[model samples]
Target: MTDWQVHALKYADRNSRTRAESFIFDDNHDAPHAMDYFIWVLRRGAEVILVDCGYDSEEATRRGRPILRDPRDALAGIGLKAEDITQLIVTHLHYDHAGGLHLFPNATIHLQEAEMAYATGPCMCHDTLKMPFTADHVCEAVKRVFQGRCVFHDGDAEVSEGVTVHCLGGHSRGLQAVRVRTEAGWLCLASDATHFYENVFENKPFPIVVDLQNMLDGFARLHELASDRSLIIPGHDPLVTTLFPQDGPEFCWRLDRGPSGDFNL
Candidate 1:
């Protein structure tokens, strides 16, 4: 199998009060949750595949989420420039995950067909379901489709050698997760399917779910896809930085290698 280097770039983080009842579907009192924002990069030889374009500083300010640094700058820290990337996988159309679409001008954006429909379809007519998406970001994706830069996948599809995307509608109507073959083994990048390790480990669903059953099932699918529990990476957990060894001073962690320390499974 062809192996690739996986890197997680953390762009911003926020601390919020969350209860186990809200996040886990179980009754538990208040707990502090660290919501970290990140974009992933996969590299093999000279090929680069980016996953989830992180939101820009303006969106951060408007949303009241402080920016640690621009996601583009975070990519630069790992020796990559936005324009140089030719392929990107969009987990979903949420503003924080897809807002930076304009940054990668020349890249082919891969997304789930259902996601595009969900973002532009009747569900968006309600403000509650549309809160996570920025109109401009969704509109730009439509433009990309017209420009021949968007590739919509019906379900599971291979992005490159050893890298595959699986559509698992849970948090959104078309959310997907990426599985990549790494030096360690097959690592499942459980994007929003499982926002934190606890979500999967404890069988707790996040509060902002569109389909609760699908979200629970997605967790099972992640376990089935990954080589092992430790190889599965969550979407917005601070423990990712602590468990995985840092590549440098910036928030880059090399996912191709084994985790630096033990974490409760």
Candidate 2:
């Protein structure tokens, strides 16, 4: 397998959120639970594959989540421009995940078939089910579909020789996780499949869930995909940057090098 280097680039943050918003049944719900936004990049020479582009400024305002840096601007930290990305893996259609679909106009999007349907289908009629999604983002994806720029997967499929996406519908109807082969071992980017290490390791599910059972099953699935517990990078955990060695510019962590210190996953 071709070895790839992975970097988790932080772009935005939400510090006011509490544990109740993150975990479904935690006793310490009042405790502060911060979430950091990031867009992951996998590279091997000039080839660049992006995973979940961060939300644009519009989404930040509408959702009350401010951006520390624009997702497009954050790309410069890794010497990449929006036009340079040729492949994108969209974990789900949530506002934070697919909100910048239009930003990567040059890339072919990789998404689960179920995710597209969930975002556009009847399920979105309910406000609770639709809260995390933005209509414009879904429209952008639909436009991409018409433009023949999307590769839809049924469940688990390979995006590249060393990179793959697996459907783990729970947080969102079609939320999936990205797995990549790196020098350190197999590293899995658990995007919303496990928002924090505790969400999986402690058997807690994030509050915004579509299917409770699928969310529960996905925790185990995340562990199964990675070589070690420490290698599993959670989606919104602020600890991810500290867990892995910092690389390139600020807010960027080199996931391919593994953890810099014992995170005690």
Q: Quick one: best TM-score, which candidate?
A: 2
TM-score, every prediction: 0.96, 0.98
Residue-level lDDT tens digits of model 2 in 120-205: 99999999999999999999999999999999999999998899999999999899999999998999999999999899999998
Please give the TM-score that candidate 2 achieves against the real structure. Answer: 0.98
Instruction: Report model 1's TM-score to 2 decimal places.
Output: 0.96
Candidates in order have lDDT scores of: 0.89, 0.92
Q: Which portions of model 2 miss their true places by more than 4 Å?
A: none
In lDDT terms, how accurate is model 2? Answer: 0.92
> lDDT tens string, model 1, 1-265?
5699999999988877566533855565577666888999999988999999989988888888778988889999988999988999999999889989998899899999999999999998888899999999999899999999999998899988899999988999999999999988999999999898989888888877788899999999999989989998999988898899899746899888868867566
Best by lDDT, which number? 2
Model 1: per-residue Cα lDDT at residue 239: 88
Global CA lDDT computed for model 1: 0.89
RMSD vs true structure, all candidates: 1.4, 0.8
